[model samples]
Target: MSIADRVRVHSVETLSDNHYTLRRATFDFRRNDGRWQRQVRESFDRGDAAAILLFDPDRRTVVLVRQFRFPAFSNGHDALLLEVPAGMLDAAAPAARIRTEVEEETGFRVSGVEPVFQAFSSPGAVTERVHCFVGRYRPADRHGPGGGHAAEGEDIEVLEPSIEDALAMLRDGGIRDSKTIMLLQHAALHLFPGAVATPGK
Candidate 1:
């Protein structure tokens, strides 16, 4: 039987609809042993987002952004989180949205974006599938000093670090954001192979 046939949703209650929708779902699932089990779970429908790692192959550097994340700070992570340029789709195409986001957050206007993959950042609690991509940029592509929209309260700091240094940041826990880590790893393996030695086996 398909997954739709294997489970049934009893109800979904909207707990909150402020910034994003938060809902509690109650459902029944058919177990592997033929028993039916009922479960309740809460998930945040924060909308899907797209992210891109802007890289300059010639400069061997990648563009990143640093911004304060309230959730992280509330959880005791007091540092401005470093991440790839990303934003909510808001009905826009993933590719188009990310291209705009990169330009807005990093000041780089990237044209050709190579999609890497899509994945649920937190499937158990958040219904947000992040569309990831890697795009090439050049120093000439920077047209503005991107600090994000002040009206939206996005005070972003842009960073351009070498691919090697980014990998080291990944290893040393400086780059804790999941999307950034994934794209950097993709760069390490595919885009800039042999740029840096892999960790000890």
Candidate 2:
């Protein structure tokens, strides 16, 4: 049996010379109630991927970034956030893409990056898939605490804390990125027996 959602291509409009707007035709997926519902969603219609950087089993620490987030601010809190190295996978190779994001976002060289998993970031509203991985980080070898300026208005801070400390933050509700949380908790349980979980940054 195949478990693929039925999708219909309703209409397509050109967003720009380089991009397109996909207006998907509405056909309500029948629920168990057997009622026909209709809904419409607009897809940006771009072929893009996402990237995540996992600082390897550093003697005991993970490299993270603290930055200003507009979303959290609008909701109720300040705009600053602690997050793992991450960005869109705009490159050819996912691992290499994440490695580059790590260095650019946090100024760390992620050596032996291993692909752990790939999953949907927001399947309901967006078609964004995140390539999650563990990148080996070396402090002495990596050049500096690195960051960049973007048109998107981003300010990032680099941080390195022991895994134990990161775990404490997780338990205390400091970490937030869902993908990073899943990766770090897995690492704490399997990579370091006694090490605690903590970083979303």
Candidate 3:
């Protein structure tokens, strides 16, 4: 049976609506044995986001950002995370939002961004899908010092790491953010083309 035929939504209760949203949902799942099971789940609804990996083919480098994440800190991980330039969609198209985010977070105006794929960051409890892209950039494209928006409480530090170093970081767990790791590995596989082995191969 299709997913729609296998599940039913009973109700959703809004738990919060500050910056994002939180909801508690009641639903019914049809089991493999044709039995119905009622379930209650809480989900965080932070809208969708877009992320981009900015690479310079000639230089073999990628631009990234570092910033403090309160959630990670609260969960016993390093608060400062190194990740691809990303931001919420906030009513903007995925491609358009990524362009603005790249410039705002990394000081690079990139064109001809190639869409990769969309993936859910946390399918279990968070309702956020990240639209991913890869784009070519050059040093001349840097137009501003990107430190993120002060009014929005962003103190992002822009970073340009060589492709080799980035791959090493991924192998050594230095780069722990999932989206960033995916983008970097994608660059290694497709953008760089045979420069590195596929992970686990």
Model 1 alpha-carbon drift over 4 Å, by segment: 197-201
| Tens digits of per-residue lDDT for model 3, 53-79 | 999999988998999988888888765
TM-score of each: 0.95, 0.77, 0.93
lDDT of 2 by residue, 1-201 (tens): 552454334454443435434445444554556664566665554444544545546477777678887767788766467777777665467776777777777767656777777878667755667777776666675776676466666678777777777777778767776776777776787667767444443
RMSD of each: 2.3, 4.0, 2.8
Worst 10 contiguous positions by lDDT, candidate 1: 192-201
Tens-digit lDDT string for candidate 1 (122-155): 9999999999999888899999999899899899
Ranking by lDDT: 1, 3, 2
Error of 1 at 102 (Å): 1.0
Question: Could you tell me which 10 consecutive residues in candidate 2 have the lowest summed lDDT?
Answer: 3-12
Report the lDDT of model 3 for residue 198.
Answer: 31
lDDT of candidates 1 onward, in order:
0.91, 0.66, 0.90
Q: Which pairs in model 1 have colliding backbones?
A: none
In angstroms, the error of model 2 at 70 is 1.1
Point out the higher-scoring one by TM-score: 2 or 3.
3
Provide the clashing-pair count of each candidate structure: 0, 10, 0
For model 3, where is the 10-residue window of minimal lDDT? 192-201
